[model samples]
Target: MGITDFFSDVWDTFAHPSPDAEAPKGGSSTETPAAGTPEESSEEAEVNKQDAVKSDESQQEQGHIPSDDAEEEEEEEEETVDPKDKLEADCQESKACAPAKHHYDECAERVMGQIENDGKAKEDCVEEFFHLAHCATQCAAKPLFSQLK
Candidate 1:
């Protein structure tokens, strides 16, 4: 699984305590950690309750959910140091570029920083610049998406 998934599994494990597999007893505490003192048990319970509250609140917040862009970037970065991840990500149009509300970051920067007469980086920036324009045009209903894929 992914990093978030792995972390989520760990969090689930710690947060939800279930009855022990072999414990069908009537007297022993099967759900809570057994070895802790009374004070520690109370403290742990309190902490868990607080964590639950925090997790629920975060889930309800606006526009904070994980995005494919972030996950892909993390995966690609882990796998390689090539700038092509950046280039490929910069030019994508559909769901790959969805996480960005309006503009892909690098393309935005390149377009905004397009210096005329000084054509040093102009050749390099051409691909992203056109792709950004085409993507925006598609979003505006003129439809340039098919031209890329």
Candidate 2:
């Protein structure tokens, strides 16, 4: 499931716990059923337990371990998606901070030009840089904060 779905499920579990659930707080439906239902004989229960043990033993003997690819995929997905980068890109693409970005770029270019043409030390564009950063931060803050824990 996606992050949104996961959070939604968590919210739903707390907000609308099933009345028939054994515990005060409801649990996931994915849990295994309780053992020894009415239809199961004692002999059958014993046989089932033995079968389960044998299956486990055979798996261990064969070195057959379950893959955690799903977990790995989830981790990879999170690692690949940098919310800050995404937010910054969004701000740039939307041109919400265009004026500030343009000013910063102009200041940088002017500083570089002076250094190259006049053989002078490069001038700092701290003010312009901060102005651009502040604009981008303003655009990024809401979405970026929402994505983070």
Candidate 3:
């Protein structure tokens, strides 16, 4: 038997505590049950067959898919938008952090210009970047977090 079947058999042994389940003479614990017994009954087989037929019938009734647009829409609907994205979008839309953002952009441009001209940047934009982040976070935190669970 498979590992799952063996585990289930072990679980059944412990749950029921049957006396017939004696330790094997020479074989290991991973041994399968004797081959004479059937794994599933005829009734069980018939029920499984019926279920498969019903599933096929349901698919047939649904008919052909029109286009991939429906699938794309479903995927978009299913996706959970991140809260950070909402905060960033709100910050951009509100323009409350515009001054800080402009300063950061100027610092970044200066660094890039230095690198292009001299093959090295005189200063990193960490201070300006942190100022911009602080402004954005302060402006966006209340509205964004209040809506989240």
Residues 1-149 of candidate 1 have per-residue lDDT tens digits of: 89999999999998887657556767877776567555456777899899998987787585466678878887777544654344444545456445442445665566556754354445355555565655544454423334334
Per TM-score, the best of the predicted structures is 3
Q: After superposition, how far is residue 149 of candidate 2 from its true place, in Å?
A: 6.6
How much lDDT does each candidate structure score? 0.60, 0.80, 0.79
Off by over 4 Å in 2: 1-80
Q: Residue 140 CA error for candidate 2 (Å)?
A: 0.8
Sort by TM-score, best first: what order?
3, 2, 1
Q: State the displacement of the C-alpha of residue 133, model 1, in Å, after optimal TM-score superposition.
A: 1.1
Q: TM-score for every candidate vs. truth?
A: 0.18, 0.43, 0.45
After superposing candidate 3 on the true structure, give the runs of residues whose Cα lies further than 4 Å from its correct spot. Answer: 1-77
Which window of ten consecutive residues has the lowest lDDT sum in model 1? 140-149
The true-versus-predicted C-alpha distance at residue 7 of model 1, in Å, is 88
**What is the Cα-based lDDT of residue 112 in candidate 1?**
51
